[model samples]
Target: MDKMEIVEKHKLLSEKIADADMVLVGVGEEFNEDFSDIGRFPHLMSALEEVDIDQMLEWTVPFLEHRFLIEHNDGRLVEAYRNLYEMVRNKNYFVITTCIDENIKKAAFDTERLVEPCGNHEMLQCSDKCCDELYPSGEFSDLVKQAILDGVGLDSLEIPKCPVCGKPLAYNNILCEQNYVEEGYQRQWKKYTKWLQLTLNKKICILELGVELNLPNIIRWPFEKVAFYNQKASFFRINASSYQMTEELSDKGISIGMNAVDYLREYQHL
Candidate 1:
C-alpha cells in the first residue's frame, strides 16, 4: 500500500476501537528510540560519558531527567500519547507500557488505568538488596548534578545510602539491574490483571504498539492470546515492521506495518 493507503488504514483504528466496550494498549521498547539519539540532550550525555559512576548512572541519569529528555524528543512521542488518549480515554481502557522512562505518564491518560510493569525511575532501592524499602528517585539528584557540574567522578561524591544496611541506593528501574523492587508496581499490575478479567467476555480493542520480540511475553504474546480467545476482540498491531498478526487471530486482527508514531499522528490529523 502507498502512503495514502497507510493513512486510510490507520483511520480504521479509531473507527474499530469505537465499537469495543473496552480498550487495551500495550506499549513496547520499539516505540522508543535508542540512546544513539541522545545527541538531542548533549549536556546529559556529556555527564553520563565523562563522569564515571559505579553502574546505575549509565541507566538512571537519562530516566532521572526524562522529563527533559523525553518531552523534548521533537514532541513526537508526547503528541503520540495525546493522540492515543483522545481515542481511548472515554472507554474502559488500560495501558501497559514497557517504556520505562515515564514519558507516557507525562501524557493526560488516566493514571489509575496505566501501568508500567517493566518499572521506572521514580523510586530507589538498596543496591545490596538489604531490604524492600524504597525512596524517592531524586534523593541523589543533587549529588549527580554536583558531579556533573564539577566534572568529577560520582565515586568522589556522597551518594544516598540504604537506610537498613548503609549500602548505596540505586534507581529502582529494571534496566539498572538492582534487585529492582518489583513491589513498586504490583498494585497497578493487579489492577491491570483485574481489568483483563473483565474483558474476557466483552468487546475489546487491543492496540499493540511498537511491540517487538524483546519482551514478547509481556505484551506481544499475551495480546495474541487475548485476541485469539475473545471472539469480539479487534486487534490492531502497529509497528514499523514485524506487525504480522498471529495466525489464530488473523480473522480479527489488522497488522499495520507503519511506524507507531506516524500511525498515531494520522489519528491526530483526523
Candidate 2:
C-alpha cells in the first residue's frame, strides 16, 4: 500500500483499539527493534561466533543468561513500546509474546496480565530435569557480566550447577528440543485463556505488533480465529511486511505494513 493509505489505515486501527473494551497484544522479535544489543537473535548469535553449531546450546547458556539479566535490569524501554503500553494501559489488556527479553516488565506492565509462552531467560533449570524448580539467575548472570567486563574468557569460569542435582544448569528459555518447565508460565497462560472466554462478547481488539509469519499458531493464527468468530472483535496487525490477514478474517481484520515503533509513535499522538 502507498504511504497515504498506510497513514489512513493506521488512524482507523488506532481508533478501533483505543476504543476497545479489552485489548489483547501479540508481540514478537520485531518488538525489540531498538534494543538490538540485548534482544536481537543475530546479535546473540554473534556473541557465540567462536563456537560450532553443534555446541550452540553449550555456549548460548552463558551468553543468553547474561543478556536476559541485562535486559531485565535495563531501566529505559524503547519509546515505541512505552507509548504503546500507555495506549492500552487503561484498557483491560493481556499480552502474549514470544519475546523473552522482559521488556514488558520493564515497561511496567502487570506480570499477571502478560504471558511469555516461549519461556524467559532470567530463570534457569537443571538440564536433566532432575528437579521441578526454576532458579533465579541473578548471581550467575552477574558473574558472567563481570567476566566479560574484565576481558576474561568465560571458559575458565565454572558453568552454573544445579544446587539439587549438581548437574550443569541451562537457561530456562525454550531452546530447540529442550525441555521447558512451565511452573510459572502456566499460571499466566491459564489466566489469559480464561480472560479470552470471559471477554468473548466484549468489544475486543487483538493487536498484533511486530510479529513475524514464522509462528502463526503461537499468536497470529489464534488471534485471527478469535477475531473471525467474534463479531465485535477486530484484528489489527502492525508489521513491516507480511501483514496480510486470512480471507476468513477479512471482514474484521486490518493490516498495515509499517514499522511497529513508527506506527506506535503516530498512534501515541492521536
Candidate 3:
C-alpha cells in the first residue's frame, strides 16, 4: 500500500478499534524475548530437559526458571505482564497465549500454577472427581489442533487421558495442559469467545498488535475475513517489515511497519 493510503486506513482502524465492543488479544513471547533481561539460562534449560511435569510443577521452578528473565530495573517482566493483564481484564478483550512456561501462565493469570508450596492459592480448585463440567478456551483448543495439524500425536502433545473415566482429556477450555481442568475457568473463557464471535459479525476495528505471519491463523484469518466483508471494519498491523495488506482488504486495512508500542503511544495520543 502507498504511504498516503496506509495513513488513511490507519486513521480508520484507530477509530474502529476504539469503538469496538470486543477485542481479542493474542499474547505472544516475542515481546518478552525482546524485553526480558534473560537471554537464556543454561542450567535451567538443562534441568528442564528431564521432561518431568511433576518436577517442573514444583513451587520453586517458576521463580528459578524465570529469575533471569524477570530481572529489570523497573521490573519490566512483571509490570508488562500486569499491564497487559489489566488491559484485557478491564476492556472487552480476550487473551490467547502459548504455553511455553509456567511463569508466563502465572503472569497471564496473575496466579500460581503449582500446587505444591501454595496448594490452596492455585486459581482453580480441584474436585478429584470425574465431571463433564469442564470446557476449553478457543486459543488452547486451537493450539492443540495446530499441534496435531503439525504432525504431533495425541500422546506426544503431553495431554493425559482422564484419570477417572479413561476418556480423552481436554485443557479447561484454554488448551494449556491436560491438568488444566477447572469448570469455573472454562465458563469465563467461553464468555469471551461468545462475545468475540458476536462482535465479529458487527462493524468493528481490529488492532493487530505485533502479530506476524509466523503466528497461527486463528486470530489473523478471522480478522482478515471481517475486514474483507465489512468496509467499516478496519485492520491495523504493526511489524518490522513493511506492512502489506491483501488487495481486497487494502481499502479498509492499514499495514504499518513500526513498533507496536510506539504506534500505541501515537494512537492513544500519549
Q: Pick the candidate with the highest TM-score.
A: 1
lDDT by residue for model 2 (9-37), tens:
76786688778989999987676524444
By summed lDDT, which 10 consecutive residues of candidate 3 come out lowest? 113-122
TM-score of each: 0.85, 0.82, 0.49
Query: What is residue 52's positional error in candidate 1, in angstroms?
Result: 7.0
lDDT score for candidate 2 against the true structure: 0.74
Clashing residue pairs in candidate 1 are: none
Report the number of the highest-lDDT candidate.
1
Candidates sorted on lDDT, descending: 1, 2, 3
Candidate 3: lDDT of 113? 18
lDDT of 3 by residue, 1-270 (tens): 355654665566545555776555543323433424333544444334433554533433333333333333244434455544544443455554432333334355533211111111122212333664443233433443454356443234443345567564432323223444444444445655565567646656565655555544544666677667764565766655535677888677667776554444344321
Collision count of model 2: 0
Candidate 1 lDDT by residue in tens digits, 161-249: 78889987776777656477788889999999999999988999999998888878889988999999898899989898788877788
TM-score of 1: 0.85
